[model samples]
Target: MAGKRSGSPDPKRHLWVLGLIAPMSALLPSQLVLYTKLEVFWWIGPIIVLIVIPVLDWVVGEDGTNPRDEDYELLSKDRYYRWCTYMFLPVQLSGLIIAAYMWSGDALSVVDKLGLAATLGFVSGIGINAAHELGHRVEHLERWLSKIALAQSAYGHFFVEHNKGHHARVATPEDPASARMGESLWEFLPRSVIGGFRSAIHIERERLKRKGHRWFSVHNHILQAWAMTAVLFGALLAIYGLRILPYLVLQAVIGAALLETVNYVEHYGLLRRRRPNGGWARCSPRDSWNSDRLVTNIFLFHLQRHSDHHANPGRRYQTLRTSEEAPQLPAGYATMIVLALFPPLWRIIMDPRLLEHYAGDVSQANIQPRKRERILAAYEYRAAA
Candidate 1:
């Protein structure tokens, strides 16, 4: 097997890490099932995730770097990608089954409630994050898995908008999800959620127009996404009554927050240049986040290999790699995302490097290809004004 070869040390490491993430993910929801009360456990989930994980990561985190050359080729292949898609199925289905059990049990203690919340949250992660990677795959089955994962998270339209719009505009001012240089996470979340949905609707509408289909047709992804959310809501109401509505909302909110936190970290200080013709530059590996942390990368199904994802959108997640020239995060994505939440600290650490890269100026020289020209044009227009 590719993972067992002499030159495949890091791939072996990645497999080990993947093994760890799979079980941890499986266990998280089960742990939540032990919580006694839903309300208390709800807060505990964020505390453990946001506070506890970050502290532990900071203290014991491995340094990030490019994977070994031999491992890179082995890791960046279709088989691994397919494996990632396959793994998500069990995690999602398991979480769903456990959630159904918890809902059926009714009025659990704090520990049991916590277990349920954690399980749902982890399941949401598996569905959304794993699907986010799979959705980019060129293979039909992998693509279908991606959509199923998104539906599980109740964010089905993300599969459409993310591929069509987000990739095209990422790190540019036009991207609502791209965090501006000094923007806080608090400021970015609402804007991104609202703007991203709007952009998705617009993209879908244009796509439908091209296909001679009406915007309101059942084929529209946005409408379909809304319908899915409604169906989930109705199911909850039917199964657990009105009391469970708040928990469902909480789950969705946590899932959305996790997605946005990742967005904030991935392109925190990256920018594209404008072309002479006023177009943005095409994305390169350097335009997105890169990390080679064996643990988190595996846990995230190689999502830390983001530069590859942006460079080759159709590549499967398991096949993502650390590009030679892509800017790398200092550690895993989870650690960076935590750092991003504290803007002052983030700026203190990152601004100097960014300013050095731009030589204290924000000109065409610092931007790339077509993006450079557009940026220059914008500058010139401003000067004229």
Candidate 2:
């Protein structure tokens, strides 16, 4: 979740209504892909994942507009969007089970095994996306479902860190989930993963302390989710044996990586200003980049509209709107993620925008500490010249 918005709307059923179908696309092929040879089936999910979705993201352009304020009120009560996420639980679990069955029992080459593992990872990542939506609500059922989905990726503690720590600290220097100005994806990955875990523990500890509970107890939110993950994976290991272990780990890593990539993209190089009162400025659309590309918007539950999601963290994704003030991404999450892997290319595309975002005032930006002096000198000098 990333930026700002004001309510607006159109009465005509907007295309975003179709967003419900997007997550299911990941599940639709589970059975069909299994019917093909391991070589062909293994590649099917990834192709639809890494290639087709991005292409659709490009062709469909963007819908920067939001539903009318009245429409939003109506949309919020519409059970369709909420139920869509609920439906995600079954498809995600079934897809994983079927993919594992095919991989474990069906004789396959090492290449196919890895490829199938990746395919399952793609679905698991999509499941996490759904869980993210569910996890944000105050409702008990939504929280439970969100944790269950997280179990598939073995990244359940994300539910706690994200809602508690990330939301409060996002776009600030202190937020590990927010990528630093000059930090490469390679550098951000390990930091975000390890630091986020630690942050979750810290946040959960503070929360329990407020409630008069000890941090070390299994009752801590982080441990509760992690225990769920353990039980889920333990059951898999018990039944599937050693061969399935690698498949599980590979998929889980990719799923978690998917989450990190989004976090990296969501707030890359953006920072909230520090107040004289020692508080960070309130988050605005300008503090986050946004992409309203049609395909990724729906596919990710309007998460590409990072600005609105951050501005209204509790706003249902269906009603999340975009503001013109946010930094616009050059492409959707799928494309940006690929670019992120190559730092030089990403820097070329993003660094100038980062400078431009701060109106060329390097000091206005929250920069990477190690290179802060070098960056400030170069960019600040360029602006002066």
Candidate 3:
């Protein structure tokens, strides 16, 4: 069923190397601070993610070009693409280790240390994106690497919850990661974190039960994943002393918050309709909100091609296509992340978009249960009008 790519060879084949920017951005600040003796450079990681990338996205604009269907096989098989992500692990670990050293030392003031922690948090958050790409792969090494990447944020459960839980129930009321119509980022974050954690445990426990494995057995994937985090954090604490604990915790919280913020953006208010048999409809390209801005595509490894991803969950990052049916985001994830922090601003921008996506049907969206009456009152009139 694959069609040949009629155009010249993939234009972006070599450009995939630029994916290194996310991991390298963390280390760039350290080198700048080293040479210039300015602590301000410690803030570069967040600045690059929050400011520079969004600016680049605006300037460079969206790239709707998809790798031709015929090329998906060749492109996904390329070892070079695999290495681009594999190389991220070293740079990411290096950034965290370097941050631990700096956080433990007395040379930097509290403000400077906090800035560095924020930088590392963004790095860790972006590392989660790397883990996401890797975690979805069927390869054992890549799956293990996914857990290692998640170790930085102490969010090892995501490896299970995402591939198992989210991809199953996305765009539905049952999915905690799927933000409802009226849910703000603040309200959604805690629900997602706690709910996802519980879901991961439940998933793992069910798997273990089927295999006749005890709850405490080595076969527990969640325990195996969390063990890596324990060893990673323990090693850092052992080397850096206790002074770095607060910053360690701070960066982890920031990293987790960043990941959850992106989750809130991915499927905000989208819903899968129930079928005649009371089953949910299959997730289609239209279920996930997608963006294809070139910069964020490279940075997040085509994660914004999300609708295709949910549709073809096994597809590699480089080969994920933009879908015509997917509801498009006004801006890339970086810009949207900042907007999501403010509830009113988020509703002002996304509420109408959500309504519009469902053809002005307020009943079609996955709305927050507590706010459903108010949301209907607010938007149903507009829908009818």
Candidate 4:
């Protein structure tokens, strides 16, 4: 176990409350619009996530502090930290209902509805982060909550694949979710979405077969999860009618895109080496990127301490630690997410940093197959020199 920091009280003790900001952010724009009668507030969700949080991350700066080893049990057992994530579901669902009502009533202009959908998209995307935290736990309720949270984005299969598949093959060439060098986020997004779903189905099918259950049985976790999405969307459509269909689809796409963007950043160009036995080496802290930026750390529930989370998958979010061995992102996920949308800009900022991480060895990093030759031609000479 890593040594704990020497602080008397956890500095982020109260700031953990800010974790609620993303889900609450969805409600805020509506309340603000009510108060100010400005249609612009409908766009506040993206503004808060993409703009305000990045600025706050820069201003608040990094928080590399870790909890005392003894404090882990106390913090993890705390109901307060659990509620911080649990509360997100209600607020998230409420925001969708509120948005649906608005969309159905024709109260919002087309542009205003688009803004509302974008805002909800952020809430749904951030909800995936919350689901990621809960899905890793052993408790059945937490696992089910994870699936329910994903219902909004229609990405419940993530619960199955992420825990069983992505974690198993992360940073390896076979993992679609792990971005490679020379592959743009635009190129990686659809690949991950489709690949992850197919992988989840295969995993669930085998699991059910081993347990003597049919793959189509309700006990199949992947089917159970997708069923939740179907029910949620069905109820919403029954009440809201087809007018909100476009908004729902738009928000779902944006939400999925946001989740995949973070996936691209988390393990971009990092690779796990093969062992003497021909099996891939066990995952270590360095396989995942780490960031200690305070604002994002709170919003993401210590997800920026990803190296620790990946190393200890069973650890609760409140107790996840940071490791100096992990490669660090130059900024928080929010900042990196913006950079990821532009392929050239993302490569310019991250490619050199990745090479530097591997001590100038381009082969040590994962490279996209189609661009492998071109990438090596460009960097291998400099690496050799």
Which residues of candidate 4, in runs, are more than 4 Å off?
1-9, 381-385
Q: For candidate 1, lDDT tens digit of each residue in 213-272? A: 998897776676567667756776786676555556656666777887788778765788
List clashing residue pairs in candidate 2. Answer: 2-310, 3-306, 3-307, 4-285, 8-67, 8-68, 9-67, 9-68
Reference-based lDDT, each prediction: 0.65, 0.79, 0.90, 0.89
TM-score of each: 0.79, 0.90, 0.95, 0.95
Candidate 2, residue 307: lDDT: 86
Estimate, for each residue in 164-214, the C-alpha lDDT of model 3 and write its tens digit: 999999999999999999999999999999999999999989989999999
- lDDT per residue, candidate 4, 215-312, as tens digits? 87989898888899899899999999999989998998889899999999999999987899999898999899989999999999998898888888
Give the poorly placed runs of model 1, Cα more than 4 Å off. 1-4, 7-10, 13-80, 103-115, 225-233, 362-385
Kindly state the number of residue pairs that clash in model 2: 8
Q: Write the per-residue lDDT of candidate 2 for residues 211-233, one digit (tens) a residue.
A: 89897786776777778788877
Model 4 residue-pair collision total: 0
Cα lDDT for residue 75, candidate 3: 81
- Give the Cα error of residue 93 in candidate 1, in Å: 3.4
RMSD of 4: 2.8
TM-score of 4: 0.95
